[model samples]
Target: MKTIRSRSDRWFDAVNNVLIAAVGLICLLPFLHVLAKSLSNQASVMGNKITFYPIGMHVEAFRFVFAHTRFFEALQVTLLVTVIGTVLSLTITILAAYPLSKPEFKGRKPILLLYVFSMLFYGGIIPGYILMKALGLLDTIWAMIVPLLVVPFNLFVCKTFFEGIPESIEESAKIDGATNFRILWSIVLPLSLPVIATLGIFYAVGYWNNYFHPLIYISSVDLKPLQLFLYETIANTEELLQEQPDSVRLSMAPEGFRAATVISSIVPILLVYPFLQRYFVTGMTLGSVKG
Candidate 1:
């Protein structure tokens, strides 16, 4: 039997499509503007003539940013922290989540409550900074990685996915004389790639974009991440310009410089997304679905 769509159904579909397109454009337009401004000639950028496309196209801003030694150092620091932190965070989250997913585990509920409580009630930045200072993590890369080893929300997402796994699979592994650790390593983890990829990206993106923790804990210029560098670049542009000779400052485009720096900082992680794109939707669905 052929099913006929109702008029109201068609109207609702049209409205939903329009709203989704609108939302996408809202998010996309700002990035387009930044890209256009970055690529545009200094005069066009300064005159605010650049919009979604480059006006009097030029790559001078990109050239200047790439040549900057400080920018490269910050980029290296950010890449290091993001990779190391994401790996550590995922490892810890998996260790904790797997145990909590098992209903037979004693005190699981209490442990879960503690994790949830920490998420809801965190000590403010001052306390966190003081703790980092006391631990001698201040002004170090460890300060960026250690303080955010695990996120409770991500832990719960992994736990939910684990809980959904059929017990029969583990039982079969047990019959084969597999230990708990062996089961987790060889069996459970192999089956949980979707959630792993999802959480990995989540952790990676968080560490990559982190500026607040860096701002508070890291005082050393050498330890600053790309985000802090970008912030300082824009924030100090005017002061830097004032310090420069009038001819040099007049020739430079501060807005274009800032935009190019922003793009460069974000481009690496953005490139990484497409490789993990296939797993993302599946991971979110499986990890979030709770019975």
Candidate 2:
């Protein structure tokens, strides 16, 4: 059946669409400006002639970024952390959440309360650094991966989603002499793909964009992640540009190099997001609304 909309409804829809489009454009404009600056000629960039579009297009900025050895090293470190961290986090979260989702599980309430409490309160930065130091995780890649393995909010979200699963499905599996682990592995996980994908993206993005923990824990230049590398590049653009070969320095402006670094750091997450976006809303809504 087609529903008829009143004139006011039409006006409201028009206004809402216009407002949303304006907000999206507002957010997108800065990124476009950065992209333009990265591609524009040094003279065009220095003269403030570049806007949303490149005034004098060139790939020199990108070529310089790609040729930098530190850029690849940081990229490699970030990729390792993101991939390994997401997998480990999802495993730990699923294991913890599964037992908590079951009302019959022993000490569920206390354990859950602890998670919630920790979520609400945190030890300060110094305490966190001390803890990492004590654990011998300082200056190691594990320093970045271990500390964020189980986010309380993500735990609760997973637990709630698990609770929403119908009990009858598990009972049928049990009647067939399937073990709890078997049920979870063969049935529960397969059915929970949306939530998994949603949480995977969350974990991946967190690991990818993390800077503070790495800044404190990672003293070694070799272990610094992409975000930290990008920060240093932007903060010391003039020095970094001067260090570059004269050909590179002549080919790209400091602003162009900074813009290129920014773009390079964000591209991985941008590429990954669209693939998982279909599941993101569904998982978040179902996981959040159930309990």
Candidate 3:
């Protein structure tokens, strides 16, 4: 059977499409402009002539950034924290989420309420700093990973998704003499790939872009993450440029450096997202559906 749309329906569809396209351009144009600025020559960048495309193509900014020792060190730090933090966060979230998803678990409500409560409130920065100091975690890489190990909202999302899985699968595994660990390892994880990939992206992005925690806890120049390094570099560019010998400063494009730094920091997540986008969409749909 085929149904035909009325003129009014067609009009509404046209309007919706226009609005969605406008919204997408709004989100996309800024990145394009930044990319243009990053790649454009210093003269055009400083003149603000580059918009969505490079006016005079150049790669000097990228070369300068790649050659900088501080940038390389900070990039390494960000990668380490992102990889290690995402793995730890996923493992801990899964362990906690699986147990909480079980209806027969005693104190589940209380435990869940505790998680919800944490989500609603936080000890302010002073207390968090004090606690980090007490634990001797400040100024170290663990300082980046430990404080944000498990996000409560993500935990609940995973738990809710886990609960949506049919109990019969677990029962069948049990009947086959599979231990709970075995069932979770072999049966549950394979089926939960969508959610796991989604959560991994979430955790990776969070850790990758985190600057506030690093700003507060890290003091060593060598220990700062890429985001923090970028922040400091941008903020102190004038002072640093003034200190540089005239020949070096004359060649460096501050605006191009800034744009390149922004691109470098964001490009990793942009690269990773497209690959996981299908799983991300599927996971969100399944996780949102009430079982």
Candidate 4:
């Protein structure tokens, strides 16, 4: 009977749903554990007593971070870098990718090869450091972003996406007397939102999480980004061993503060993620099939 068949289908769907939910929870459990550990008491954390839920719920860790002298300032620096760096990287990447996407463009192959070559073989860190030093980017915010602006992987993906667009559509736009720039701004971009949003999230997250560049290039305390500041606080365990007065060392649990910093770092990512969630899914399947 048709009714029996419908019931069977519903049961299959329910089973699949349960499987998916179980997998989702499995993947999420680690992050949840970290969050719980971060809010739990330092003593509990030190004793290896905390699990997926807070033990002896405490506010010291969050309080310690909030009271840090450079916390807010570093946060602002990181925000500025994320916003400005994402915009610049997006602009340069699109301009580069769009031209490369057009086969008719002379020497496109060579340019693309050059981009790909860098990915396979990179100049080692010493040379890169020398180049940055020569550029006078040391001790500057530009040091963090300028070096990593155009990622070759993202560039290739964008170029591939653009190439996947039907040439006939572009031809029609051209026939309508729309200039290439105009067409890009008015038409191509609107359709390319999926990839753009995905790339924006990539760039934003990259910029937000970058710390080593600042550590190496920036010596000025005021110029350091939030990640570097947090790293200095949490990752450098030697500080805890220093024979400093108890008054100087706050009672905040190091583990909890680390958690708070991680949480703080993830907030922007979380905020931007919802907007890009649709695009992220769409971009992954951008050209997987042609219809």
Model 3, 178-279: lDDT tens digits are: 998999999889988878988888898889889899999999999999999989988877776677677656765788878887887778778878887886
The 10-residue segment with the lowest total lDDT in model 2: 282-291
Q: List all candidate RMSDs to the true structure.
A: 2.1, 1.4, 1.9, 3.4
lDDT of 1 by residue, 171-261 (tens): 9999999999999999999998878988998898889989989998888899999999999988887676567566656766899878888
lDDT of model 2 at residue 46?
A: 85
What C-alpha lDDT, on a 0 to 100 scale, does residue 255 get in candidate 1? 92
| Ranked candidates (TM-score, high to low) | 2, 3, 1, 4
Q: How many pairs collide in each candidate, listed in order?
A: 0, 0, 0, 0
RMSD in angstroms between candidate 4 and the native structure over all alpha carbons: 3.4
- Model 3 CA lDDT for position 34: 88
TM-score of each: 0.92, 0.96, 0.92, 0.83
* Cα deviation of 79, candidate 3, in Å: 1.1
Tens-digit per-residue lDDT, 113-150, candidate 2? 99989998999999998989899999999999999999
Model with the higher lDDT, candidate 3 or 4: 3
Clashing pairs in 1: none
- The TM-score between candidate 2 and the true structure equals 0.96
CA deviation > 4 Å runs, candidate 3: none
